[model samples]
Target: MQKPYLEISHVNKTFQRGSMLTDVLRDISLTVQKGEYISLIGHSGCGKSTLLNIVAGLTPVTSGAVTLENSHVERPGPDRAVVFQNHSLLPWLTVYENVKLAVDKVWARESASVRKDRIMRALEMVQIAHAMDKRPGEISGGMKQRVGIARALSMEPKILLLDEPFGALDALTRAHLQDQVMQIHHALKNTVIMITHDVDEAVLLSDRVVMLTNGPAATIGEILKVDLPFPRRRLELVTQPSYIKAREAVLKFLYERNKFVEAA
Candidate 1:
């Protein structure tokens, strides 16, 4: 078998709170293949976001290791780009500038024209080329998230990490952006790992859904393979029997895990 594109081996994370140590993640292990779309879902505070941060090297792991293509991950690099829950765009800069910042940072040695071309291409890919001149404050939440997606993709990362990237948007807007994201993934075929609480969203986008148990120290509760074919249609697929079955499996895992945590 080919080596996994991204691997997390027996990872754990703990935080210090005053005089006490709070364990957040415990013995988490997962392997994601190239071009795979994986979603992590669980109750609030289940360390799903923490795990994404660990993958991005935005947060340090207390134990174990995260590896990409056989090398250990110790710091952030252009090879892995993250889209945060909040669209972390610069309000002072135009949407084009916001994306340009990332492209320039990662490819600073390239000529100016090359950098500009790359940024514009990413914006076009996200269908936000029309909003290139607008600031984040001037765009809708969904549009800002698109800018975030554009910035991340502009880096041409090996893996894309998204932490609840549409969690803050309204229902219709979130649905629309979810479709846009799925379309982008289909076209680009980049490896993607997203942390989301939306079961329907997970079913519509992922190749597999991994659930984490509730945490003071969270761990993987279950992994459900999504048998639905892609390029997936959000509305049509959501109503299919396979999609319903997959969503149920994920929901049951999260519900049962939360109950287990509550009783402990």
Candidate 2:
């Protein structure tokens, strides 16, 4: 078997709040294979985003380690690109420029024409080629998010990290963007890790869903396999019995886990 592309080993994180040390993640370990799509799901404050930041090397782990291709994660690099929940695009830059910024930064040594071609290709991959010249302020929320995704993909990272990329959109818009994101992933076959609270979205998008325990020290509670065939469609997936069952399992886990955390 091929080696896992990313590995999180006995990871822990703690924060200093005034005089007290609060643990946010505890003994969390996972391995992600190449070209796999995994979703991390939990309630708010469950440290899902924290864990993604850790994997992305945007934040450090207090203990243990995160390794990509056998190299320990110490700092953020072009090898791992992130798409944040907030659609962190520069307001002054047009859609094409926003993506070009990332490509240029990562591929600075490449010829200017090569970087331009890469940027345009990434925008086209996300189906945002038509909006290439539009500024972020002029675009819809979904379009802005697509620009964010395009920017990330332009970097051609080994692993793509998404921190609740669709969390802020309306339900219909979120669903539509999910399809677009899934299609992009399918075509690229890049390893992806997404943090989300939406169980249905997780089931529809991931090869596996890793449900985290509630925080002040969150850990992996369960890793549920999504056996549904790929090239999934939202409406078709919703109507399928296995998809429904998998979603219910994740929801039940969250509901029960959160209740236990509350009572403690």
Candidate 3:
């Protein structure tokens, strides 16, 4: 049998504040094939983002390991790129400059023309090429997010990590960005592990939805396979039985498991 492309082996994570020790994730193990799209979904307080951070090498695992291509992941590198809900673009830089900054660092050995091509390629991939010269403050929220994703993509990272990347957007912009992401995944086939609370987005964008149990020591509660085909259209899937079934399954799991959620 072939080994997993990326492996998270019996991992655990904890935090220390003062004299208190809080267990966040326990015995969490997952195997992801190359070029797979996986989503982590759960209510607030779950360790979904923590797990993503571990894979990104932003934090140390209390125990166990995460490896990519059989090499241990110990620190943040060009191999893993992350995009969060905030976009985190630099206020002083224009859109083109924002992405160019990453390309310059990752492909610094390359000549100036090569670097420019890298920056333009990523901007075009996210359909933000025309806005390259615009500053983040001059653009809308959705455009800023496009720049953020382009910046991450410009590095040509092996794994893309997203933490509620679309949570702050309006419904229309969010849907549009989701489509852009799906198109990019189809074209690039980059391995992705995204943190999301949206059930519909999970089912639509993921090959598998990895749901976590309620926290302080959250673990995988269930993994639902989305048996739908690629090039999924949002409007067309509204009445799709398989799509409906998958959506309902995720909703069922989320509803039954998140009982601590108090009704507002």
Give lDDT per model, in order.
0.90, 0.91, 0.93
lDDT of 2: 0.91
Tens digits of lDDT, candidate 1, 1-264:
988989999999999989999999999999999999999988888798889989998899999999998888989888999999899988999999999999989999999999999999999988899999998989998889989999999999999999999999999989888888888888889999998888888888999999898888999988999998787887687579988888888877866647734310
Q: Pick the candidate with the highest lDDT.
A: 3
All candidates in order of lDDT, best leading: 3, 2, 1
User: lDDT by residue for model 2 over 1-264, one digit each (tens)?
Assistant: 888889999999998889999899999999999999999988788798889999989899999999999999999999999999999999999999999889989999999999999998998888899999999999999999999999999999999999999989999999898998899888889999998888888999999999998787889999999999889988787789999899989988988757743311
Query: Model 3, 212: alpha-carbon shift in Å?
Result: 0.4
**Clash list (residue pairs), candidate 3:** none
Where does candidate 2 stray beyond 4 Å? 260-264
**Per-candidate RMSD, Å:** 2.4, 2.3, 1.4
TM-score, model 1 to reference = 0.96
TM-score of every model versus the real structure: 0.96, 0.96, 0.97
Kindly provide the TM-score of model 3 when superposed on the true structure, using C-alpha atoms.
0.97
Screening candidate 1 with a backbone cut-off below 3 angstroms (N, C-alpha, C), the clashing residue pairs are: none
Comparing candidate 2 with candidate 3, which one achieves the higher lDDT?
A: 3
Candidate 1's displacement at residue 255, Å, is 2.0
Off by over 4 Å in 1: 260-264
